[model samples]
Target: MRIGITYTILRREELEIKERAGDFGEVFMLHEDDMVFPSNLDLDVVIIRNVGHFKALYLARLFESEGIPVVNPFTVMLEAGDKLLATLRLKDRVPVPDWRAGVSEKASEKAVEELGYPVVLKPVFGSWGRLLAKVNDRDALEAVLEHRKWLRNPLYGIHYVQKFVEKPGRDIRSYVIGGEFVTAIYRYSEHWITNTARGGKAEPCYDEEVRELSLRAWEAFGEGALAIDIFEGSEGLLVNEVNPNMEFKNAARVTGVDIAKKLVEYALEVAKA
Candidate 1:
């Protein structure tokens, strides 16, 4: 099958996914890296790798409108793109991070009054530790929200305000595809966030319990696979975020899964239907 995979940034995960699909035949790595396709080439499947950027969003639309079978669809991408929306949909099902979305000024004050200080402030749509902040006091939270409101950035407004879970500052990235967890990796960081893009180290986690939570997260999405992140601690697991078109390389080696093979099989299965 002819498959076209888009890469917004040449992260190691994107590169490896391209290489893994090589065994499946005609795995085109679509990039501005001078990638060229035949003018009339017919791609059976187009995989949109979410780079958590507007460009990927635009290009994904282009392919979807062209009637190409886009994995995870544009709607799925957009749904998973917004943390606030995902959080609302996933609450109580997966121990979703104690989050409140689209809060009014009065509501924010009330929630903060009840939930206490030191909640997390995140842009509704963000990835890899970019533009995520923690607010420790009402003054700081209100100031940040005011600035973001004036700037019309939905990062603070129309976003998620989550209760902070003290984890010694580490999180887990559970890579899922095809209704199973390909692997689990602990992203350790002294800093608050453990995004690989932000200098976090990835470590292997083979705990079957973690793997089960990971699959449950994907299943919770209803259809299509997703990468489920978790903030784990003595209290147990709290769902961090869900990425429909997830990046997976640190996870592949850590869990010892041949990610390429597994992903190709998933694509073929999806295409068959």
Candidate 2:
């Protein structure tokens, strides 16, 4: 069996997966810039680690066309990569924050009024808390929406607004591999966005509710490796977002779980099947 790990830059998780993949099969690190489609390649499975990369998705699609199994398959990437689509798919089955997708200034104003103050305005395609704004008032909402109008990417023009859930300054990051709950960590920070990239500290969370809710959220996305971000709402856990290419370096460090090893194991199992 042969395994391919797609990435742009080598991160800690990718590095660990590459180093350990030898135990499973011949591992190839395919960089996005170096990928050439419609070319011959030999691989039993390909794991897409680089999220939000067009080239990576193309490569995954190419490999998938050849009947090579790609983890977090292109179909899953298409559904999980877009915030609005993921929300729409999961809103009916899972507890996601109330959100509205609109492209006009009037729509933004309507969403704000309906969802209330301090709504989170996010780009449809984004991660790591980049370009996410909390509109506390109409003036701020207008300013943010106006600035987004000039964005070169049309995705920014479509406002993705969500009602911000008041939490205890933290959120849960749960890792689900092969449709199984693996581990979770609490991303603690003073700011509303508790992403590990935003300097949030990772702490191990032993809550069964977190595991249950995370699994239910993953069920909405079907099979593949996923990271579900959940918030501790007044009613219960509300899923903030579901990531197809979820970064697990901080979660691994805090939970003492060899996430890369688990992923490689799952890849080998898929290849054998």
Candidate 3:
């Protein structure tokens, strides 16, 4: 069997995945700088890593056109890579926080007003909790919007506003592999945004609601390997986001799950199928 991983630079998780996958078969590290589009490559299955969305989509679609399976699939990547798309897809199917999408400053203001104060203004396409603003009032919303208007990337102009949920100083990050819930962790921080990338600490959590909701969210996205971010809301557990190419080094350390090994084993299963 042959497995291909798309990456520009190898992070800790990527290196771990590479090492574990090597135990199965020949592993090809398809670096972005060395790849050429519209060319046929021999590989049984391709695992899309932390590459950018457009490039990852291009590679996945190219390999898929030639009958090679892609982890998380191109469809999942298409939706999960964009916060707006993922929210729309997960709405109604799962318990997701209320959100609105728009393109103009006026529309963003209107959305903020509708969603009420303390709303989260997020870039449509972002991760690691970067470029997220917790707008407490009109003044803050105006300031954030004005800054976005000057940015070169038009994607910055697009607004993804969500109602902020008041949690108990932490949130749950659940790992789903091959349609199964492997483990979960509580990311705690004094700040409102509790992303581990933002210096939030991780602790092991074994919650039934997290598993059920995470599984439902994974199935909503046509399940593969995903990290589901869930918020404990006043009503119930709400899914905040679903990441296709998730970062799991912190989660692995806290949860004691050999995530890379399980991920590689699943990728090999895809290759075998």
TM-score of each: 0.87, 0.96, 0.95
Model 3, residue pairs in steric clash = none
**Candidates ranked by TM-score, best first?**
2, 3, 1
Candidate 3 clash figure, as a count:
0
| lDDT, model 1 | 0.73
lDDT tens digits, residue span 35-129, model 2: 78775778899988775556556666888888888887887777777788888878987888888877887987897898899799988877899
Residue 16 lDDT (model 2): 92
Q: Which stretches of candidate 1 lie over 4 Å from their true place?
A: 32-41, 154-156
lDDT of 3 by residue, 172-193 (tens): 9999998878999999999998
lDDT (10s digit) by residue, model 1, range 106-182: 66667666677788877778688776778899788888777667866544556567888788667888777778667
- For model 3, the stretches where C-alpha displacement exceeds 4 angstroms are none
Q: Give the range of the ten consecutive residues with the poorest summed lDDT in model 2.
A: 51-60
lDDT of each: 0.73, 0.85, 0.88
User: Which residue pairs clash in candidate 2?
Assistant: none
